[model samples]
Every structure is written in structure tokens, then in C-alpha cells.
Target: MSLRIVPVSFHEACSFVDEWHRHHRAPQGHKFSIGAANEADELVGVAIIGRPVARPLDDRLTLEVTRMATNGTPNACSLLYGAAWRAAKALGYRRLVTYLQAEESGVSLRAVQWKIVAHLPPRRGWSTGCRPRTARGTDNVARTRWEARIAT
Candidate 1:
């Protein structure tokens, strides 16, 4: 299917966030999200980012990309990540962050131009604890982190 990143309005975001929480309820809790829309304008993927309310000691806003998903194809995740990075940059965020699960081995996070900052701690409950009751597949998970600097 055709995939594109679009600006989700406040009301639209609310609905998507609600649906996301229903599916994935990880430990730190869900945060604002940038969404991926298909040809039919249906939300097929989401990249949730944690924008810290208070700036930490680093002075750079730590944007924790709490989640990423696709309707089926893994390619969808890269595009969604690109979209979220662009969005976060435009919003004055200094950096973008995300973690891949422990068992998701086949889940490829390496994109041609994206940077791999570190190997993060394995996420505890992406599929079992917070994933949607209907979600399937769990072997490709792993502890991974991806980051992009938004500003100099």
C-alpha cells in the first residue's frame, strides 16, 4: 500500500493515541506520536516520541521514541522514523531516540542513512505487556537505539 507521513491534528492525534495505548502500554508510558497514513488515509503505523516536559542536565531535549509499527512490511518503519525525526526537528527537538525490542531479531532498524548510536537495554513488554491483543510475531525483537541530531 501507499504510505505517507502526514500532520495529525490534535483531535486526530487523540484518537490515534487512545488506540495506541490500547495496543502498547510500556513501562514509561505512552507519549505524543507522529503517524503514518496509507493511501486510504488510515493510520497504519505510528512513531511515538517522549518529549521531556523539563529539559534534562544535557540541555538537549531527550526525545525517546517509545514505539514504532507497521501494517505488515518492515519498510514502513524506516519511513515512519524519517517522518518522526523530521517532525521532531521542526518542533525544536535537539535529538530523536528509539529502542528495538530484545527478541525482534528479524526486525531491521538499519536504514541506508540513519545512524546507530548505541545498543540499548532490551525492552520488557512491547508485545506481551502492551501490544494489542490482536498483534502477532515476536521473534525479531532486540535492544537497539537510533538517534538523529536535529540541531547543531
Candidate 2:
């Protein structure tokens, strides 16, 4: 599929989520304020900016990049992320925040030249039948919060 990011409607975003979940089982009902379309005009990624979960600091919305994916292109994730960020800025969001799996591709970050404003300390929270969990807790929250606050 050729590469290009396009905005998708809520229904289309839900369909993308369904397809993503088919390959990777994640929570349903992901909310995305914007989406990405490829060169083929196919939806490949989605982004959403939500109201601050903890507080509504000075009318700023939290740009929560809930989900992002690419069919196969190396730079597709970046395209999606850039488009999403631009969209967020267009919508008057002052900050953007997202959580990504270390193992997953960091194409989006690289594409946007996203800096690591902060990082969370390693944590030890294990799941019921899963292997050891990744780090968690205060450090992570602090870093994420900081990034959200600083991202423009």
C-alpha cells in the first residue's frame, strides 16, 4: 500500500480498531479524534486527544495517541503520528501524550523527532498468567506527565 495518512470518521476508526484487535487482542472502544490513511487511501492509524484524566489544567486537552499502526511501510507510522500531531495542534490541544511498548516499532517517534522529555523507572507488576511485567509506577507517570505537558 502506498503511504499517506488521512483522517477517518469515528465509525471508520472503530473498524480499524477491530482489525487491529484481530491481530492483537487489546481493549475495545478506543477513542480517536483523528486517523491516518495510506497512499492507497486506506486507514492505517488513529489518534485521539482526550480531556485530561486527572485534571483540566487551563483548558488544555491531553493528546492521547491511543493507537497507531501501518500495514508494512517503514515510515508509515511516522506519517500517521505527524498527521495526528498536526491535527491535535489544529484542534487547539497544547499537549500530546502516548504510551508505547518498548518492543514495538518507534517509527512514529523517529518520524516526528520526538524527544524523550522524561522516562519512568522500572517496575515489577506481574499479570495473572503472564511473564514478568515491564517497569511501572511513579517514575513512569511523572515522565509521561512531563512529556504531555512539554509536547507542543
lDDT of 2 by residue, 1-152 (tens): 55665556666665665666323322344335566666667666655444443344425555566555445546666766676667666777766666554444454576686655545544334333555443333222222322334333
Candidate 1, superposed: residue stretches over 4 Å from native: 9-23, 26-31, 52-60, 102-108, 121-142, 150-152
In candidate 2, what residue range of length 10 has the lowest lDDT sum? 138-147
Taking all chains together, each candidate's TM-score versus the true structure is: 0.61, 0.62
TM value for model 1: 0.61
Report lDDT (Cα) of residue 90, candidate 1.
81
lDDT of each: 0.59, 0.53
State in Å the error of residue 12, model 2: 1.6
> lDDT per residue, candidate 1, 1-152, as tens digits?
67788665444554554555434443244446667778888787666666532245235565766656556544667787777777777877777776555444423445624566667553443345554444334333456556677546
